[model samples]
Target: MEHVVLTVQSQNQLQQALQQLDSSWLNLPSGRVLAQVYSRNLESGWLLSVSAELRAKLPNITVVGCSAMGIVSAGSDWNNATVVSLLRFDKSSFVATLLQSSPDDEYLDGRNMAAELAIKQRDLQGVLLLSNPTKLATTRLLRGMSDELVNLPIFGGLAGDFSQKLSTSVMLDQALSDAGSVIVAFYGEALRIKTFNYLGWTPFGEGMTVTSTQGDVVKTIDNIAAYDLYNYFIGIEKTGFFSSAMEFPLMANHGGKLVARVPIAVGEAHELVFLAQLEPGDTVQFGYGDVNSILSDLSFARHDLISFGPEAILVFSCCCRQSFLQDDPRAEIQPFEDVAAVAGFFTYGEIDTANVPRDVLNATIVSVGFSEEPAPAAEEDDWLITERAEMKMSRNLNRLQRLMCFISRMTEKLNAKNQELTRLAQLDSLTGVLNRRAFEEQLAQEFQHCRMISAPLSLLKIDLDGFKQLNEDFGHAIGDQLLCNLVDIVNRCVRHTDGFARYESDCFMLLLPQLHYGEALVIAERIRAGVAQSLTIKGIPELPKVTCSIGVAKFHDEQDTLDALLSRVDFAISRAKSAGRNCVKGE
Candidate 1:
């Protein structure tokens, strides 16, 4: 339940840090040691040697660590610094497992490791993971663990080589490698785990719909090349896209929370490659991180840890955050020390298992707090400085959000108005069905398609039985209502691809592609019955019944010109009226 942090500048200084670990209070016979090592400019062998030497000195201590580009401990940022965090649980047992995996099959390796550790699944309370970011798919590895260990809370980060050379190393029990992963699963009843993952990225601009994706590479966004979309919206040169895009990554709605997806590298084919997968049809928006929002979220994280009353807190912060807040990355970790002892390293992507089984995050800060005894609730005013800063930041963000929302609403209204105008141009003013011009244009297009594919195409010409008489009896108002009512009925009874239009004052047209003469006759009969059954005057509910007579005709490439086909259907309609007022006749 207690921890000692050892910060060293060199190997000789590391010996001094070891003296701090030998305090008498931690020298119990049953005491177990957990140490996380962070070093810079050091070879993997020397790091392993340090771990081995620690094991030789402490006898029963377990060691695990990774190469961190930046390390945080005791309220300060340490760039190219080495830190050794020592923890000894006073009342609980510790079980450690170090897993080695090939970069190609890390998913299977995760499943196997979970299966091997399944025996202690029930006893597991928390998990700490460190892995090589370049060699493994961060999301797939976490998914494998989530599938097997559904109830355990997992938190950790990807290892970072300070030199940015992809030489990250993960060490467990004297073994270290830059290509595999290491997991430290904690087993005890006294372990209390709570994690907070916060992304302060503001979403702006038009949202892009994901149209095509292959695994982790998003190929086309909105059916355009992903690279082109980024270049157009971001307006950055191809060489600077990666660095500039980091300021505004893509944010998606995953399980009702915004998760940022960082594009690591671009492919030669112009794919925006990410460490996570985005499914087609998911809408993503470009997001920008601001200092006020970032600091506000950090303050909230510290407050959350205070409320949880944890004895120690471990951070798995995104390296991009460091780059964004380059002058003062320590602002994130400094406040946490006010609540508990703090230690963590920068990661390429952070894993947050506090919510559902779906919590792999980027451009976020993931804080995990550990506690054995619950601390009494502290007054809200205890952290007043941070609270005021948060309040001020929230107000500013709220105002910005409100203004942005207003502009967005106005933009949406304008877009909706434009859509309505376009719709009106193609629709009849009275009946709300396709106008003569639109219907004829659609007919020509459908005819060309049918000719190309040799598909069946049918047309129907419908005339009201007594539209002129109805208008004379009840005036044009009632006549127009009857026409609209009949159009509604026919529309409901036909396929969406089938076209319906108000061809004239008393005549309607229907285009049925992929249908023959017999099929068209059946549809025309259905429409006749529907109109006869549901017809009524809008205000006068039971005034009069409205009916229609329909004539059907099938298209023939050799015998039917577009004009000839229309004339034939009109002739069929005349015949239907001659045979009976309410009937369907075909030619």
Candidate 2:
């Protein structure tokens, strides 16, 4: 290999203007191959077909690529076509993994796939990855691969579309072709990998220490939910809890022009949902106040890259960032040619392995240039990666693990919160009982559990007799309040284990465990009596009276499931409805 050789720019046309450029020179045949392609968000079959054509040219390709945000067109908009940048060298040296749309078989093994690729590439140095930033978890993917490759380098960026809507990643291979990850191992000295990328942003204003954070949600800053810190920082005294506070650009020092020197968008939330990317214990303050200064710093990073000595390079950057420097992104890299450089298209998310002590978490980039010369493997050092991450965090990453714990625990609480919701789904929204679906499913489960325990299960079908008359006479709001108040009354009378669902608009089904026939009737009558008395909502002072008619039935060994029990109780409830309003009847 020449001290700096092989500059390949393969640009093929899909429809009109050619759209693609894959340039790689240094690791000619390594253990891994990174194949990425980006297309317009709404582009059609012809576009997908065109990409497949070029991908077919490569051997042993494991496909994983996503859409791109406005492709850099030397100052022109290139929205109609997709760009595919292929970087490959050496076979059997890299490992690629695909997470696709299918449940794995119990016998499925990933190690086997990796081993096969390793058998071909032999001396694997690192891993190259490509994934859709959309459906797939880019964050999770990188974290997972960091473990698998452990101390090995990983690099690539998210597929993007300027629209930021739904997009696809092409996973091209002769055997399996679809939208998923495909990992292949390379054998030997085909590629050289190292990185010179940084967050390239900074912190500004007075810093606020992250007090309490859970995942991306900051419960408090300065001991208040992080929103207050955001509001205080952004100078938003009114509606301090609003989402805008979080969305505002937050600045931190990754320690100079190397990481960030100003404005980087942080987190925020609105409505009842929280939306933020920052964890607690981080020191953040307002940023973007000086947009021009920030742009100057960004431009300087690219201008500085030519000094690194790359014969040719490709850039992957953040789409959220495009709008900020849309004025002239190419101007920053124009200096690349001044230093042994030929370059090509840029991307939404970029990835490169960083040698952080004992680990390598692939760093995403705003702009990174690859040099094919004997660059002496600056990537071999471990400290550079850690320094960059800590700098990116503004040296406030010490509490990230604790913050992740907070997020994990909170997630558990939210997942288990839907018991009441499940109950209401089966019942009428206003009624305080089983909804039809829940009643049925629970009836089956309770029946089975009781069958195992050899206990009795009672089913009561109840309806508000002449309830529609009240709705007609008293307006629906009063009727609704009547139903709500009625539930509170009924809940107290039922056993803790007993459940209920709304059977329909004016009807409900209650399951009473360990209750005999008489007990069921007594419970039913209690509901009837409670409803006869009118109740007031906490805010509303007036409401007309309402009552219910109840019907009851029981389960026996002879009966198989809940269906018959419901049928019998519904029949009895119908009889009560016919005979009189506000009464209990059973069969």
Candidate 3:
């Protein structure tokens, strides 16, 4: 495989670049040739003229082009210019197609396009796609394509426009489209394709739940207007929110992976509009670009590209990343030139076909490497030096990264400590059981649940028959130990679903959901027997045998309140104590 990357500023430059290609290789019937044009200029007439000139010069060349926010080439990135990449393959072939589509019918359009491409080549290896992000649903379109092209690699990006008009265009052969897609289907035994993406944005602050949404517009997050979230946290106002929010996008878990969503506009109701759909109940965190992390990831990606040894690399990087990286926008793209020729554009959103079902990503850089040769075995020193010495970090970036890490770790520790405190507050310190207040809260929840489902619920009020006398005789320390031992024995006799609590000094309560009076009575009898046999005061040869009086009461009709149920259980316990010291009774 042979390829050339050139930056063209005018029609004459494009013609000159095309003239540099070998005419013999262009005319070879068994060879495949592809020309990808990424232009920052959105003039329709100028683009059309350039397209016409290319087709006139090379009639057999497959041309796939799109409008770009910025064009990228080997070791450099350009704005308000065009980059052309010419690829000639000796053992591989490809078919290119253009399909007009409507936003309302994007899925059908995608399926139709994929179906046509699948029939074009029998040994389809991969696909290259370019579409208008503003005029179509790219995510749904990718899903439709995935339905037809299962496990097939598709890599490209949405056409980008930096002008206020926001009109993006794509070109195929001699035709240009503003509301359609262009696809190139590559097929051959010798062609090999690999894709990789790097997102170095670090998520900060607490995750907020998406409370309400309408299509791609998020109305509220954490029950407040979405705009308020950005305003309060990131200090971004509705005015120029799109540009200001570029540095900080929302990172959410989509399809089991953390995908970034960049806000394109703020609505009149203060809702944030994104390029992709977001559902309510999804958790999102504000993410900011970290220079250190980005460079670190670039080091690993550079190593992988070197090992793969591709002939050419195509980049589809997010425009937001360009804005975040500022002066050094090509830092991520320059490293690829060491292994292969590189050319692509900064996109509005990137299409990553590396994952099954594919994903439309924002604030990410997607690299697609093409090779006709197998990778060679690695040398011992090949992995030793991955990062370049020239990639130095600024003092401000280092301090910012250190501060971010410190804040993140502190927030996590504080959240963990808060959760532990909450759990401790609900438990009894001595017995490790639910305290009276916590038990009542749980019992109220269970009561309401039983009422809703019309299920049976039983409560057992247990009292140690001689707790007061034992406390005075054995001292309070031994009495406390005895209570702890008795709780362990009773816990063994009950199901995990049952709620056990220390209701008072010598009284305890057990809540049994979905259980009737008979089941509660059986459990109460088992607890009485277990405590009698297992509990014994230490350092005393023979003290009064530990025993408990249990009163089990089943919930009555709809009119029965929690207090009324407790009253009945207390009466039952009074009867048990009057009859005998150690016994079980039910009401």
Candidate 4:
């Protein structure tokens, strides 16, 4: 495989770049050639003329491109110029499709396009997608395509317009559409594709829940107007809202992965409109780009790309990243050139279908690497040397990154300790069962939940029969062991869903959700039988016989308070004790 990347600012520059390509390589009949154009200039007339000139020079090549906020070439990025990449593959072939569909028909359009691509190429390896973000439902389209092409990798981006007019275009040869998609499907046995994506945004501040939404418009966050939430956190004003918000996007978990969503506009009612949909109940945190973290992530990506050893690398990075990394916009793009020829564009949104439940990402960089050959083996020393040479950062930035990392680690440790303390507080120190207060709290919640679901709930109140007398004879230490032993026996007999708690000294309660009175009685009998078997107490000359009395009661949905349930169960236990020890009673 071979690739050439060049930048052109005019028709004359385009011709000169074409002349620089090897004519023999371009005319190779055995190899397939394709050209990709990423232009900041969205003028249809100029782009068409460039396309016509490319065809006149190299008639056998396939051409596809889109309008970009910024174009990327090997080792650099351009704000107002076009970057053209010509790739020649030795054993790979591809086909391109232009889907002209309305925004409302995006889902169906995606499904149909994927189906056509699948049928057209039996050896389909991957797909490259470019679409107009302003006129397409990107998430829905990706979902539709994902449903049809399961496990197939899709990598590309939405066309971007720097003018913010929301007008973007995708091209297929001489045809260009401002409101649809152009898909280039690559297929061949020898073709290999691997995708890597990273987000350098670190989440900060308290998490806010999505309270309300209308499609892609987020109406409220944490029950406050969406715009108000932004203002409260970042003091963002309506003027230049999109640009400001791009610096700090809302990071939320989508399909178990963190994805960023940039607010593009503020609605009349102060709702924030995003390019991607925000579902109600999603917990989001405000995130900002950290330069040190960004550079560190690039090192990881660089390692993977070096190992893959691709002939060409295509990048679909978010335009917001370009804006945020203004001081060094080419930091992420330049490293890939060390491994292979690189070309891409800064996009409105990036589509990554490599993982399950494909995501349309914001403030991320997604790199797609292509190779027709297997990866070459490299020693660990070589990787370390390359990583050390290429991975460079300012001293102050590195120190700041280390400080942030230190704080993040310390915070995690503190949270873990807090959680452990909470767990310890809720548990009985001796028997490791829920203590009285925690059990009561849990019972109240279980009661409410069972009532809401109209499900049965049962409780068993257990007491070691003659426990006080036993403790008086055996001493407190032995008595505590007996209590722990009984707990172990009860645990073996009860279902996993049963919640056992130490109600008081020598008394315990088991709260069972979705269990009827009959089932509860059976479990109580099992505990009684297990306890009656015998107690092998240490230092005891003879094995002491031990037993427990249990009372079972089912919840009355029509009129059962937590206190009432407890009272009835206690009364039933008293009845069991009055009848005889080592028995079960039910109410």
Supply the TM-score for candidate 2. 0.46
Off by over 4 Å in 2: 1-12, 15-35, 55-64, 72-75, 86-97, 101-122, 166-170, 173-187, 211-248, 251-277, 289-311, 338-350, 355-587
Q: Candidate 3, overall lDDT?
A: 0.83
Per-candidate alpha-carbon RMSD to the true structure: 8.6, 17.8, 5.6, 6.2
Better of 2 and 4 by lDDT: 4
lDDT string, candidate 3, 307-334, tens digits: 7788989999998987876666666776
- Encode model 4's per-residue lDDT on 1-587: one tens digit a residue: 88788888889988887887776655654227788988898665767777788878887877889999887775343657898888888888888788887757888888888999999869999989888878778888887887888889998999988877778898888998888888888989999998999898877766789999988899999899999989987999999898889888999988888899999899999999988888999999888777656877888888888888899999989989878656555667777877888899999899878853556889999999999998778866755634422534446556756777876667568767878988999999999999999998889999999888889999999999888998888889989999999988988887777789999999999998998888888889988998898544767865368888998888998567888888889888988999887899886
lDDT of 4: 0.84
List the candidates ranked by lDDT, beginning with the highest: 4, 3, 1, 2
lDDT of each: 0.77, 0.50, 0.83, 0.84
Which candidate has the highest lDDT of all?
4
TM-score winner between candidates 2 and 4: 4
For residue 386, what is the lDDT in candidate 2? 25
How do the predictions measure up, each by TM-score?
Answer: 0.70, 0.46, 0.80, 0.78
Q: How does model 1 fare in lDDT? A: 0.77
Ranking by TM-score: 3, 4, 1, 2
Model 3 TM-score is 0.80
Q: Give me the displacement of residue 137 in model 1, in angstroms.
A: 3.0
Give the Cα error of residue 473 in candidate 1, in Å.
17
